[model samples]
Target: MFPLLEVLKSLAQLSLAQLSLAQLFTATVIIVLSPILTDRIAAVRSILFSNYQDYFFPQLTMIIEESDGFSQNQLYAAARTYVGVLFSVSRKPRHFKCRRAIKGEKLVFDFVGEDFYQKKDIAREDSIIANFEGIKLEWKSRAKINEHNGETVSKYFELSFDKRHEKKVLEYYIPHLLARAEEIRKEERVPRLYSRGGSGLGEWLSINFEHPTTFEKLAMDPTLKRMLKDDLDRFVKRKDWYKKVGRAWKRGYLIYGPPGTGKSTLIAAMANFLKFDIYDVDISSINSDLDLRKILLSTSNGSIMVMEDIDCARLEKGGQQNKASSAKFTLSGLLNVIDGLWSNCGDERIIVFTTNHKDKLDPALFRRGRMDVHVHMSYCTIDGFKLLATNYLKIEDDHQLYRQIEVLLANVEVTPAEIAEELLNSSGSSDDVVLARLVEFFEQKLHVKAKAAELKERLKSADIDVDAEGLVKFLKQKKLENAKEKEVEQLLNSGDTDIDAEGFVKFIKQKKIEDAKAAEAK
Candidate 1:
């Protein structure tokens, strides 16, 4: 060591040209190894310092991986969204490249609507700083690749914060991120409606669901609407509670209503409110239970599966519906998918059944856990009409015709769709005119209902079984019989023939035959 130090001192004093070949070679070797030796010493020092620092002022890191062996981790997805929103809101340019929204994808424009394509800013691997409630946090994103395949096997985010803030980070910051991410998704996502495509069996086709229905604008009972919203809130927040109770994280709703009522619209409102996709299941197109399972299992989680006009579906096992039994879907299969073991396949799923004739359905379908919520979409009430008036005509305050319309609505049963049509048809006119047209339509409907009631009562007095179509047919037949009797009475009064009671019956029969022949000839 002393000799080396003397050589280094002599080299500092000597000029480069005067150095011997052996000295030059020695200097070259020292120069070559200096950076490597320095790096090694620094690395050892860093390790020791890190150990001491970690032992005293430690940090806690929460790792959220992209996949949890089964599915994508919810926290990982939320972190990605939250980080993107954070950067955008902070108005800061990040070092890593951000994902750009491509054409045909839903674009979320800021208030200024500039740089529209930059909305998607999720990075594959990057680090960002976040400050939450006076605590500084570092978020690191990383990807792990498979060495053999050179393909990314997993991606993760590390949220590192001061160990003292661990509880707050877990209890508050994580939840806040999830809530904010959900809000961002709701704002940016275009609800998609899925249907079975003709291209392949069990394949789904999606289209952007642009229905504007919302709970605020929906024409339903206010109390019921509030209850539905509250129920949804409870359902979404009770994920862990559901697991504790051993219940599938799913819900079933049976919406029964007459035609022209807003069952489908209510479903659209629910989807918009929840930001869930709609899968309209056409049971007629689904041949058997196996086919139904294939279709249902293909649907993603966090979606609504709707079976409209469920009463028309072949649910009953026996009777006339038993023809081609093997080819038809059954109620048991539906129940299994909705509430049985198969329901555990997905989480946060909603099953909706709509039927015009609820009474026609089997009681088993409405068993406690199967169809949990039953919503009867009744005819439009006074409140419903007011909602429609406000929606269609932008009429917030009550008009002079409101009282009359309310009275008519009380006495009659008209669906919201019918009222909407009336209002829509007269929308170009004044509010008064539009409302008056609606009132006139209501009065006409009332008059028809009154006439029908009178006819129905007359038929009952004559001991006739009156149905809607039968009433019209019976009226025409009664008119024809009365005309024949009048003609026979006129012949008797004219003394055209001396006919006894027995002969009268024979003559009437002959007249009936002739009348039938004449009608056929015409």
Candidate 2:
């Protein structure tokens, strides 16, 4: 002890440069590591204390985090919502500060307004006691933070219960929470629309979908609309039946129609009706079957996968040979994604394909387990027009021009989009004027149809057998004298007057005779 004290006193009395290089290095490292060692010791002490407490208490903790691997865990969401229900309906806390909330304000239970819950109440991070079948569980909200950055990583709920009730909690309480949370979610559900974005090949971007279309407002045939609604209702409610039959809980719809026949609108209506989010899948964007499978599997249950213009994509044809050399996206791959085992990944899903040319698509795409329902969106009809008028013009069914418009609609093959455009363009006009404009538009269409028919007949009589454009081209060609050609041109351009085919034929013969006479004189 005397020797150590004498050495320390000698070192203290020495000059700055008198110490060796090894001593200086050791001093620097010790100074730098002092705080680190202290923190490590404190952490070890806390962990030891916690371990002893847990051992004595004999409690098991189950953590429900906000996210699982790549997607959100459904149980985590349900627990979050179910916690709100506990706060609302459970016994009042021993110590809670009471305050009045604003009128009509939504509480933690969004579906339960202030008027329903009496007042908005629920404090964050407060522990709640849940009693389930005589077992007591304590739930506390917790958040994890990054140790280095001090930023929040995720929030979670810690459910601590007696270790003896593990079986009951696992078998009964968790399922009850899920079912109750689902009920709460349904009361306040707002469907969303999800589509692939430019970020990545399989990334989905979403937004709230609030399209104001329903079965009642659709221009489709009422009978078909009712049938579709019935079908959807049946599909959603048959989960148990589906399990009994050993089939996946999903439905497919093939909506095929002309360009403007409201196939998209029908999809929107179905989404709104079923409270399902829309997952728009672009086949062209998908490069391979693996990418397609990943995208489809990433989608949640109760979503509509709408792949529009399926016929336009460069997909492999059904039953084709040399599939090994086919494009990256193949019909076989698509079939596996839709109807094969991969399809069983999600439940209560609806797959919709839209195309203007249905016949151009592979027949395998429309088979029974693939596209279960085939909906043909035809041209506008009288019933559809009435629905449109009621929606746009707010007119009754017994308008003065209803009969005329109905007759014209029956004869003409105009789309609902065309009628909607007419109505939208005439928004400032009165109902009569609007109906008149629609009638005039229909009449012009009829006139155009009559002209095309007349031209087709003329070409047929002359043994040309060409289309309308070809017939017009034949008339425009300078085959006769300049004056005769000009006369034919005027007749062809005339819109109000119908082409007199017989008279035109006679004039053609006369022109030939005149040409012969002129040739003889020459």
Candidate 3:
């Protein structure tokens, strides 16, 4: 029994040795052919997954839709974040975003996951998953690829199939996301962008509530920029006719003020702010109201349509009543441009009407729904003066001239144009002298206005009403006619004709001045 047992042990030992040797040989064969196998696998994949370009976009879209809370903001932010990560520690990529590229009639990747989040944090860990039906087959391939330079493995897989996700996020996805986000933001602001009240009949005039000459540099005004940015954002995104929303959002401005204020400037600023073309509709230039309506209808979106000095429009200038004579255009024709049929021609359009004489406009012009807002560019106020000083003179707030300017602003009616002209002519002069000169100029203009007022008062007290001083002399020439007529009437009853020319002339001129004074009183 002992001999048989010993024989069994030796046979078992021999069987174990032979099995170990066979396994070793198999291991040696695999180790030697591993590179070839790997190359074969790569070649096969290059063909099998060659259609990935076709699937890339669809896959990305699906992923985005499936992801929770993947809003436009997050998408836009992600695109930027991915690209920024790629260039941060490197030589700094000149291009900040990733995009699709065309290679031989094929869409190719600019970035993939490995190219972006290749760092040692969540990206290198098991956070990113791989799938087949979920494109799971590509998962192992993708996780196999890592950031160049000793990155940790993507725990979901050893490598990745692609490394160009960064490019995709940056060049294609993020931009659209930002644009959509802006649209959403605009939609939210449509109701409160401006108050809807008070129609304006400024078609006969264009008054810039802000000033015209100063409008050339409107973006420089930080406050104006902020306000305008908000307005424009609402104007553009909410109801642009070009969008699928199928509506043209139009705006109208009524600028009423004393002459030479920045009413025109405000329009220019609005144009600049909105990146719009300017279509100045000169009603006087148009032969008829039909031409004016045609002009308004042709105005494009993102355009500023202006009608300057509307109070003096030839159409409204001739008579108090509306006419369609040579004008061939009626009040109704202009209304079509204001808020009627033609206004819907373009979305994101702004119509601005400026007038120096708001009082002369028709009451129908300023009804409840015509003009969106009426801005009055009144006499230059103290704050406005400082803005002019800083804009035109390059004078800082700390300058002594600013303090003196503040003082003059208290009592002066310096229009922005007047102030602008002074600062421009002598920007290099001492602040004190420049301000003194400015103050003197405004004071002189004021004095001229005062003298004109006094002359008007004298004319009113004399009960004289005339558009020009020539009328006074023209009437004075009739002194003999008045005397002869009066003398003849009196003499007819007494059988005598008497002439009192000298007394008539002296008394008439004095009485004319008194009548002028009465008109002035009214």
Best by TM-score: 2
lDDT-based ranking: 2, 1, 3
Using all chains and alpha carbons, the TM-scores for the candidates as numbered come to 0.59, 0.68, 0.46
TM-score, candidate number 2: 0.68
What TM-score quantifies how close candidate 1 is to the native fold?
0.59
CA deviation > 4 Å runs, candidate 1: 1-187, 317-321, 324-327, 472-522
Give the lDDT of residue 73 in candidate 1: 67
Q: How far in Å is the alpha carbon of 492 misplaced in model 3?
A: 50
lDDT tens readout by residue for model 1, 7-94: 5787899897899899799887776676687788888999999998798979898889865654446777677778766665454434
Q: In angstroms, give how far residue 96 of model 3 lies from its true place.
A: 34
Assess candidate 3 and give its TM-score to the true structure: 0.46
Lowest-sum lDDT 10-residue window in model 2:
110-119
lDDT of the structure predicted as candidate 3: 0.53
Clashes of 1: 0
* Residues 305-377 of candidate 3: C-alpha lDDT, one tens digit per residue: 7777766653453333244333345566677668776666555677787999888766666764466667777
Report how far residue 329 has shifted in candidate 3, in Å: 1.6
Note the residue pairs that clash in candidate 1: none
